[model samples]
Target chain A: MHPQLQLLVALQDMTGMIKEVEEKGSELEGMGFKTAGLDDLKRAREELEGQIEPQLMGAFQRLTAKFGRAVVPVVGNHCTGCFAQIPSSFVSKTNAGKLQRCESCGRILYWP
Target chain B: MDIAEVLKNTSPELFLPDLKATDKESALSELVAGLTAGMDIKNPDTILQMLQSRESLGSTAVGPGIAFPHGRTLAVQRLTILMARSTAGVDFDSEDGEPTHLFFVLIAPPQDLGHQYIKSLATLIDTVQEASLREKLMAADDYEAFCAALRGE
Candidate 1:
């Protein structure tokens, strides 16, 4: 269960890293002089993009392992995952894919 | 308009519409119109102008078939949200290279509540990106269907 939650956080950090590498690489390229550092940066960017897919898969796998599904859209006063009362309105709008915040904990709910 | 109020007002009736635009301008226009309509707010052009202003600064397309176009105005009392679905999708010069079909056009009354609006928007996106939700919206037939989709029934 912990792994499931942590996987999401990990995926977020990975995305952040990928973005930072990309921005840095672009900055280096904008300067437009081939250098060893730039080459390393390019390599890093390639590596990060490559990691994205595997990380995404890993995150999903972990979530499914914990919840028996990827993510559950809350249905009417219940956490689809935990079966608890989220606010009535929260349940109402989220099911419709409108404004969704977990009334109980404020996690954005998504329909599976 | 403050960006914060828009996110606060986001609800099912205001959330589900297929964007399916062929390009950015049409997509934004459709999105603004949809959000304004859902919230029952007056003057769609005012909100459209707000979105255009934001676009002038930079494209709101955040890539991966998503665009978060937003603006603020003093004439509004509350935030308004519009959702659009474009099965055909549109080009917003996104880095993700996936034609954008989902847009979260946010219009708000100017206020110090900007940060909360942004935070709520971020939260909304986190929810929207859930596995099949975007696809479900794309599959919807019309505005009514879109509303049903948002209501998650």
Candidate 2:
């Protein structure tokens, strides 16, 4: 599948988790859970966000930025992406529209 | 092939072929439909249905003009991937208010290949983040041209 799009989805998930943690921290403050624990939680959230931001930004940059345009096409029983050996049978099947995977890389392949 | 070498071969033959769309679904449906068919999917309905089911769980539209819809299987054969470009673009309930022109669909088989799958996905993600590449693809007027531009030729 397109990797850039996948990364974006993953970033969204991380963002949601961060939001939940923030909410929990606020709730603890309201209920007087523990100052030290709440502080720790907030710190953890910041770290996570910092890490997530660069990755997500990079992913978005690639996707919207056009980094993966040259996705290879499988040709002559070889994976164009990984150049891995695809069985002759699998290659034929993929051509026949039955679906085939590269033995090495495992990405579903199609004839160019 | 070494991962680096394989990664370097960005020709249309590696991706952007074998996708057959019988009919156009909605914007999201188009993305799902294109990917399922592109992979020569085994159970197209299964993945399609799962994506539909996900809206009930929560929106797959993760914002930023991107959406991630995935499904599980007790006995999947292998992971399959599908990518598509909608020239006209579509609205996916994104936060950026930008029309989605690019899409990636992932189908994982029921095996312990999760780590490998993630690796392949990461590579794909890296590719998508290139700004110059995106411009070329957007300029493509047809599928053939699109494929060529994707290859950077």
Q: Residue B7 CA error for candidate 2 (Å)?
A: 7.6
> Which candidate should be chosen as best, given lDDT against the real structure?
1
Interface RMSDs of the predictions, in order, are 16.5, 14.8
Whole-model Cα lDDT of every candidate shown, in order:
0.52, 0.45
Alpha carbon lDDT at A90, candidate 2? 55
RMSD of every candidate to native, in Å, equals 18.0, 16.7
Model 2 TM = 0.42
Q: Cα miss at A38, model 1 (Å)?
A: 27
- Candidate 2 docks with a DockQ of 0.03
Worst 10 residues of 2 chain A by lDDT: A28-37
Q: Give the worst 10-residue stretch by lDDT in candidate 1 chain A.
A: A28-37
